[model samples]
Target: MVFEVIGPIFLLLALGYLSVRLNLLNKEQVGTIGGFVIKIALPALFFQSLSSKDLHQIWYPGYFFVYTSVTFLLFGIAYWLMSTHFKNTMSQSAVLSLGAGMSNTGLIGTAVLSLLIGQKAMTYTSLVVIIESVLLIPTVLILVQLGMQQKANVAEIVKKTAFTLFKNPLFAGVMLGIIFAIFQIRLPHQISHVLLMLGQTASPLALFAIGGGIVGMSLKYVNAQSFYLVFSSNLVMPLLVYLGLRYFTDVSQEMLHAGTIIASLPMPTIFAILGQAYGLNEKTLTPLLMSTILGFIVSGTLISIWWA
Candidate 1:
């Protein structure tokens, strides 16, 4: 069962890598497909996942609090170290922090959790997705923008951030889904089916796009900092989430496992994409690749122990 779950993920990743390597798809084409996953498929997935469940299933205050807190803790530490100690520019620091702080809850999380937990995976993912899309990702992007526009004031930044969040497809999907869940509103049968169809496309195409993006990337640039970020993201962050929930809270066995596994997952491809934006290519790429490879070990162990 574990092999059944893990094999297809790595296979899809390899297929993506091979597709780009064989010249079947260029990087730009991969980006266009990735954009579709983010703007269309992923959002649809989020909405369908949340709207179909009740608020009781969707809301786990202890899980959300611990996950959100650990996320902020990691993001804050990474940002501070990068800016003050590493002396990276604002954009670089912000994006780098994202590498340490964020996990691939959208693409990888959706795939793995769905397989592991059945439909309950969506409920687990919805919580993490809210934390990522609505909170962590927005905060990083805002800082990235603010870093670029040095003259921008606080009020202006806040206003623009609000507008940007409102327009963000991920945010919109999460919000709409939550609204429907809270109120127990049902979508029309046809509309729900349409969303499920689009949402279903998210995991595989998104994973393929991720593999294609790695075509020209190599691990030669890995350094001490790369290892540091990898350890922080792939090891320490999840460890903290696991310990916090296990000792301090009384979440379900399922929630505890889900939260830890989510944290243990590698940093998402978006981290490298954001880093690429600010010319921090090798900075973000090495740790991302390293963690993805390492994650097979980390998450696989957790599954063996808990799901055995």
Candidate 2:
């Protein structure tokens, strides 16, 4: 059953890697696939997962409070290091923020936890995605932009920041799903079925895209210091957080596994996109790719053992 669950995910990643190797897809095409996963597939997954769970049955708000608190704290410390010690530009700081804290809560977290912890945990995973996609990304990006240029107009910054969450499909999906869940609206069976089919595509698709996207990166630029910084987030940070959760929090074994995996998820491809948009692509892309690819393998192994 576990292999049945994990098989398609690895298959899709293999397909994506193969697609890149065969020159069947270019960087832009791979990126479009990522956008599709975020916009269409992942949102469907969230809506389907969230809408099915009774709001009353889901876990406490305090769980999210703790989760968000931990995320932001880690991000804050990392950002300070990048900004002050590293003398990083705003965009680079933003990338570090993402690398340190943004977890793969939606695609990988959902599927893996469902297999290990049962379907009930999907709600928790979905909520994590909500926090990351809707709240964290925008907040961190605003800081990044500000760090890059501190003299920008406050009002303009507010306007652009407010629009950030709405512009992303994954965020849209999370908000819409939460709204429906909050209102206790029932979808028609046909609509739910359609969503189930589409939402099924998200996990493997994302993994595949990760594999292909790694092709765009050049490991040559990776330095000892950059490697260490990225490693802190991808490896050590998760281990520290996991140990803390194991001792301090009253979270489930499943949640512990989930939290660790989320912590260890590859630097979001969104970081790469943001970097490119801001012309910091070359500076940040290598570390992002190296950490992500290595993080995927390391974290996936850890999750497998922890869940097992």
Specify the highest-TM-score model's number: 1
Pairs of residues at least 3 apart in sequence or in different chains that clash in candidate 1: none
Clashes of each: 0, 1
lDDT of 1 at 281: 82
RMSD versus native structure for model 1: 1.8
User: Over the stretch 21-45, how does candidate 1's per-residue lDDT look in tens digits?
Assistant: 9999989999899899989998898
Error of 2 at 74 (Å): 2.0
Model 1: how far residue 230 lies from native, Å: 0.8
- Model 1 scores what on Cα lDDT? 0.85
lDDT of 2 by residue, 1-308 (tens): 44554566577778888899899998679888877877898788777777776676555565576677777777787778877887877667866666676666766666556656665656777767777876788787677667667596767776798787778777777677777778888788999889988887776677777778777568655775467557766876677667767777787776677777777766666666776777767656877877767776876687557544
As a whole number from 0 to 100, the lDDT of residue 169 in candidate 1 is 90
lDDT, residue 111, candidate 1: 74
